[model samples]
Target: MPSSSGRPNNNLLRALSAQDYELIRPHVRCETKAAGELLYRPGDHVGSAYFPCGPSLVSYEVTDGDGRNVETVLVGREGAVGGIVSLGFLPAYCLIVVKFDGPFVRVPIVNIQSAKDRSPSFKNMFARYADCLMAQMFQSTACNAIHSIEQRTAKWIAAAMDRTGENLVPLTHDQLAAMLGVGRSYTSRVLQAFRQEGILTTRRGALIVDDPDKLRLRACRCNEAVKEHFDIVLRGVYPEPDDAAVA
Candidate 1:
């Protein structure tokens, strides 16, 4: 299992069967993931796959008519990024943008795919994770279309909190607006509403959740669904809760 440094509070790696983990051990490389960093963009070759030791925000950007770009999904520690198109030579439809600062375990794409072929148990576990990713992406689409900005913002905040395991989320209104696909003014208004409700506290450029449950209540179903899926899918695959807790 990976040490508790710059890693997300997840049980997946630790929960892995020893034999399965050993197969991929040699290929797991640690790297820094800072906020506002871009991992890969459209047309960039998928060289590595990253699993967060901490929370990260990976967004998929798609250009619409008139060339306006919008985010499709926000990937955090709940799922590994850059694995979908890694084997398929499909051009990227989205960009992986880091939302929080932390460390992540990176494996070369080829190595990861090769490990999948070499280890059946590991392949099954990774495939399950892929399903969770699909669920999140689907939920995001629904949340974007049907939920209010305040509700969606709450969902986003909750997701970040889960990934980073911190209340102080370092994100700006402009960035949030971009991720949420809303006007900057609209994001500001929604944030003010959240602040008034005591669900969040906003400073100059960052936000801190004052009450997690309150945010959960305000969030769309997507927030809960994603967490539930992760819990269900990653169940026996990660270490026990007592064991995976970060130091």
Candidate 2:
């Protein structure tokens, strides 16, 4: 069984051996994060690292001169929210916000650095994870730029479902617009079309995917591209045990 107390309920943590788990166990702290919560603002000081225990989505956003912000990347259970610290940057313009309610384990940055200094293997794992996240971010940029709204939405739904192990995503249309960098009206239209096609079931403030296979088929090539990279590069990070939860 997984150990109790200051620990991360993440793939990386599960992958660790007894000795490796013990190295960083003492410094972890749990936190409850709700939907729409701002995990970190543009210039907030980096104090700790969050490893999501349940499902919590993180969006990277930038504000334009007109005060309108655009999302650049979405992070969920597959990885940690703060990877910029690895590059030695303290405050970045990218905003980290939670889109799903969950419990997360936070380890102080200082403690993480101390563990890195003491363990070469732990450092190697983090370095690899950082690289994987960068690759995913680049893929997301291309997908948003070239993919159709319907295709992109399908991809988003598929990714979220994979992470949460739940079909129901409790998000409002406005939130979806912010995520896709599209207008509210457009998001509503796209969702309406999907519902008509029996691809998704939308309620007052949530979307339930009724047909995942159809959704995948409708998604653009960008979805498959990012997933392929995640599979090849991240490998053991997301385990596929032939179970229905991720299947």
Query: How close to the true structure is residue 194 of candidate 2, measured as C-alpha lDDT?
Result: 88
Give one digit per residue, the lDDT tens place, for model 1 in 1-247: 2455323344456556778767777887777877768888878777787776644456666766776667776665555677642444455556777777677778777877776788888788878877877877788888888889988888787767766567888889998887777889998998898888898898988998898888888878876677677778875432221222242
In candidate 1, where is summed lDDT lowest over 10 consecutive residues? 238-247
Q: What is the C-alpha local distance difference test score of each model?
A: 0.71, 0.71
Runs of candidate 1 with Cα error greater than 4 angstroms are 1-10, 65-68, 84-91, 236-247
User: Judged by lDDT against the true structure, how good is candidate 2?
Assistant: 0.71
Best by lDDT: 2
Model 2 Cα shift for residue 86 (angstroms): 1.2
Q: TM-scores, in order shown?
A: 0.86, 0.89
User: Cα miss at 135, model 1 (Å)?
Assistant: 0.7
